[model samples]
Every structure is written in structure tokens, then in C-alpha cells.
Target: MPEPTARVEPDEIRRWLSERAAYYLERPVEELDPGAPLAELGLDSVYALTLCGDVEDRYGLVLEPSAAWDHPTLDALTAHLLAALERG
Candidate 1:
């Protein structure tokens, strides 16, 4: 794990996740719907796993591979990450 940094806000995480998901979907970050399900936004299992890795690397926190499935949407996932960071 990486060293903890300053506290992070949900919007920042949301934007980062949106940008990442958009990259995997080959879409613009503006095209992403924060309320939409990741799968519905065209993120498959491979993309999910890739995203999980990205989250770990970016946030420096260990996470279950199923974190995406558990959160399901950008909004939910952002909230989950915020909570996790708080607990961190």
C-alpha cells in the first residue's frame, strides 16, 4: 500500500472514476452518467478489473476486485471510495 495523503472529496474521486470509465468506454468524460450502472455504460468484467487496479493505484488503498460490482454506479462507487478513504 502507498502512504496516505490528505483527505479526498467525493467529487474528486467521482471525476477520476468518470474519466477512467470514459477511457475504457472510449467515450468523453462528459458522456458518462454518474447515476448509470457501470455495466450499462459498457464496462465489462475486464474493464471492471482494470478499473479496480486503477483505483488501487490512484488511491493507494487495497480493495476487493468486486468493488465495482458492489458499487455498480459512479455515484455509488464514489460514495464507497469516500467511505473507504475515511476509514483509511
Candidate 2:
């Protein structure tokens, strides 16, 4: 098996989320918050999947299909991602 990469910090996760949110929502990164729900921020299922793909590409992490529902907020998602990274 390939060695796992180091886990990203919360701030870095937040930054990554903000950038991805901006890209998917076509809005300014300054407006995104880690506590905001993706649905509340205009993310539908398709957009969420696309965002997941972007995250996987950026971080080399594969997200579960249910991640969008399970980790609804950016903060929750970041926490889950960090945990997954640690486990890997």
C-alpha cells in the first residue's frame, strides 16, 4: 500500500473549503464560512459531487459518497477529512 500523506491543518482545510466553495458557487472566497451548510450555501447533490471530486484532486483523498449528507457543514467535513487522513 502507498504511504499516507500528512493531515492538513484546520486552517488549511478551511482555506481549501473556501476556495472550493468559491469555485463551485461562483462567489467570492471571503463570503464562505467553515460552519455553513453546503445546502444553505447553494450546493445541490451534483454540485456537492463535483466539489468532492475537486477535494479529492486537491488533497489526494477519496471521500465517501455519503459525506455530503453526513458532514453537512464545512467544519464537520474538515474534521472528518482530518480523521480519515489520520487513519490512512
Candidate 3:
């Protein structure tokens, strides 16, 4: 048997976040980053819920409610999201 391949990549995760950020901020995706603070981008609880919904719908992964508070950064959230995907 062959080893399984990973479908996700760092750039893809970055792009996903970038696209979502653009949708949330009404700006270009290039302006977003893993280090960008959600508050600095004007993302509130409503936006967070929307983002979590998007992640779950798009990636087929469910994020716990606490995930928003636990993984505030894009990189951290991406890591958690990828881990959840891998688990499933």
C-alpha cells in the first residue's frame, strides 16, 4: 500500500484565511496575515461565528465554541483546523 497524501498546504490555508478575511473586512486578501489580530480587523463575535461556520462548511470540520478564544491568530487557528481535519 502507498502512504496517504496530504491535501492541505500552508499556502492553501493562508489563502483560505486570506479569502475569508477579505470577505469579513471588505479588503483584498493580500492585506491579511496569520499575525493579524481579529479585533484590529474589526472582527466581532458575529464575525467569528460566521467565520467558524464558513470553516466548518468549507472544510467539513466542526470547531468547538472555545476554539475562537483558544486560537485567536490565523496560524494558530489554521493549525487547529488542520488537526481537526486530520482527526476526521
Q: What is the C-alpha local distance difference test score of each model?
A: 0.90, 0.79, 0.72
The deviation in Å at residue 77 for candidate 2 is 0.6
Cα lDDT tens digits for candidate 2, 1-88: 2236654687787778778878888999888776889899887898788878877887778887678779998889888877877776
Give candidates' CA RMSD values in order: 1.7, 2.6, 4.0
Order the candidates by TM-score, highest first — what do you get?
1, 2, 3
Which is the better candidate, 1 or 3, if ranked by lDDT? Answer: 1
- Provide the lDDT at 6 for model 2: 55
Ranking by lDDT: 1, 2, 3
lDDT of 2 at 45: 92
Q: Compare the candidates by TM-score and give the number of the best one.
A: 1
Residue 31, model 2: Cα distance from true site in angstroms: 1.1
Best by lDDT: 1
What are the runs in model 3 whose C-alpha is more than 4 Å off?
1-6
Measured on C-alpha atoms, candidate 2 has an lDDT of 0.79
